[model samples]
Target: MAEPFPLAPSLWATTAPPGPETPPLTESGQADVVIVGGGFCGLSTALHLAERGIRPVVLEAREVGFGGSGRNGGQVIPGLKYDPADLVAKFGPERGERLARFAGSTADTVFDLIARHAMDVPHRRAGWIQGAHTEAGLAEVARRAEQWAGLGAPTRVLDRSETARLLGTERYLGGWLDGRGGAIQPLSYARGLARAALKAGAAIHGQTPVTGLSRSGSTWTVTTAQGARLSTERVVLCTNGYTGGLWPGLAQTVIAANSFQVATKPLSDNLRRSILPEGQVSSDTRKLLLYFRLDHTGRLLMGGRGPFREPRTPRDWAHLERIVGKLFPQLDGTAFDHRWCGRVAITQDYLPHLHEPAPGLLIDIGCQGRGVGLQSTMGRAIAQYIATGDADSLPLPLTPIAPLPMHAFHRLYVSAIIAWYRLSDGGIR
Candidate 1:
């Protein structure tokens, strides 16, 4: 028998507030909606749907938030992975403008939910900073700020002195600051969403892996590995990077890449004062970006791209230590206390993908490493669509699922893409 998904030994696992637990489904049952995966997306969808008096049964392969939702860097950044102007150009004027606004306002939705629910997480709304790795990168961020500012977003481009003051590092050329940004204890937030959903009458079953999906007349049937089954009028897949071949071509639509994270021992007050004095979460402008922030406990958390397979911790974390030394010379001797890695989905367009693959079947995947805010906002939109049956109210237009060409070569493609990004990061661009 296959083992259940293992809960990652991340800092969040030890620190997150207590979460709700549901036993595995043991017999046949029915619901108005069945949400696959118990990460932030699924929990948020359940919460929203239940608020509207819709009963949703959420099935988790392991525990809630066991995947990237709990293992992520915790930086609540707004917008898609791409720039706003590029989004406008790709999606067109009217559609693009709406997308840009949607991206910019996502963080607001996350913070509001946290406040309304009184979630027990370290929630901070100081801001999010994006540092430029080069002069050209600085210029690009300036343009990005201009484009978002035109849409009434609270975005500002920072010059070298300002960036250095905020980040306590002279390595960056410049950057931009989005005042709407913030950070949270990701696992706690995920659990909070589950609790909220439970309050609204959503049933969540853990250790319940959906093995098969089949349509029986007007309803969809979800078969569990333990032979338990669930019938529902609507089915939603929020598995994201951990998505498998349950539905034909669903997993093939996005590339799953590994992201590794490490946390340094708590810094002294003096050191903390010198580093990120404003407590803003930050990332850099690179093909494979570098993101870092200080947790509420004052530990400096850093994350970056990593190998696809299970990583050898010591060797993998050595790269991150060197990066910290380069960025903050004062942290030369800082010892890392925790290290972990998880998969994050990246779509071809570098944006979240919403698909209505079949009648009454919807799939939401592709986080692209900017999921904290985007996924929560998307969950609300999905619930609205389910309740009102209005496609126009969705955050992103639902499209038909088109499997990636040469899907079988995804592993090789990811390897090649990583090499290219490394080369570009090394100044060969």
Candidate 2:
């Protein structure tokens, strides 16, 4: 039962809107459903559930968006680590097609929700670019573009010249653009979701951590660290990277790795016009990828895999700073305004997991570094299944939680793998 690292002083903190008022749960009461964790998934679940006239209650360990939802790079890229064809090959046509469709349009789910709610979050939907660092990388993105285009996605392959023009960097050999993806001020989006959820009659309790839970036949009971109690017929565990031992063996199901990020101060007008001029986010194809984008205000942000343990020094972000200069030499002496990190849950098979370890309890965990869009879509699907009790309504079927063997040592190996990948990717020492 470990707590998450303290919230990082990220760029989002200065830019995001104020969180809505969320009073704590005082008296013991029963709810139609109780959701754990108040990141993107939990708030979206509460919002969608309340829209359906359900009395949902949300219990958050910290203020809303205090975890990865607020700390991530905010690139709204769709699809999973796997491609559409691979999804069909692995899960078969029936379930695979459904999963592919759900995964592909996850970005749409976020944009649509923002439009439907009129959330005043700064966002853009130009596209997401996958830069190819090697010839093989170019082939891979071309294949990805072809597969997604066949599925009617507005994806296209980019030659070397086109890539250099769009990305303002010749570091990539070539790449592809998936027009369905985009970027956002992640913390602002999370706060907006909380506002919409509260307006829809949902009850959210911030700083109320669920300490333990027990079930008796049809109902489940949860106790919080604040000495409050709640009962519900259904409980949804939306904790992703910050998951603890709230449920038996749940924390061990995925490896929570750190994704470190840095944001530069607003660039000069010439630099801004030269870098990511069209406003699409870009992530290169490397063992440990480098993802970057230009915010609407012209600040350049970059992120990548980092230390397994929480960062302890400014040196933890030196690699990203060097990589930025390598990619955009014009930014060599630019000053960085923010540096932070958050945990991203990586499942065994690199896909989102839905588990029903017990009756009347559902769990959604693991995002593989794409939580913003996937979790938003997952919330709507989980809400539909909760309201209707139809497993088919869910994008993925319920699976048993299978904790990784020797899960305690994941960090040891994960760190080693990251080191090897970093070396292979090639950069300053």
**Residue 252 CA displacement from its true place in model 2, Å:** 0.7
Clashes of each: 0, 0
| Residue pairs whose backbone atoms clash in candidate 2 | none
Say what the RMSD of model 2 is: 2.0
lDDT tens per residue, model 1, 140-225: 89988887788787888998999999998988888999888999999999998998899899999999999999997779999999
Q: Write down the TM-score of every candidate.
A: 0.96, 0.97
lDDT of each model, Cα atoms only?
0.87, 0.91
Task: Single out the weakest 10-residue window by summed lDDT for candidate 2.
Answer: 1-10
- Report the Cα RMSD per candidate: 2.1, 2.0
**Model 1 accuracy (lDDT, Cα):** 0.87
Clash pairs detected, candidate 1: none
What is candidate 2's lDDT per residue for 1-429, written digit by digit as tens? 544333447899888778888777778888999999899999999999999999999999888998899889999999999999999999999989889999998999899989999998999999999999888998999999999999899998999999999999988889999999999999999999999999999999998889999999898999998778898999999999999998889999999999999999999999998998898999878879889999867899999988888877788899889888988999999999889888999999999999998998999999899999999999999999999999998888799899999999988999999998877774532
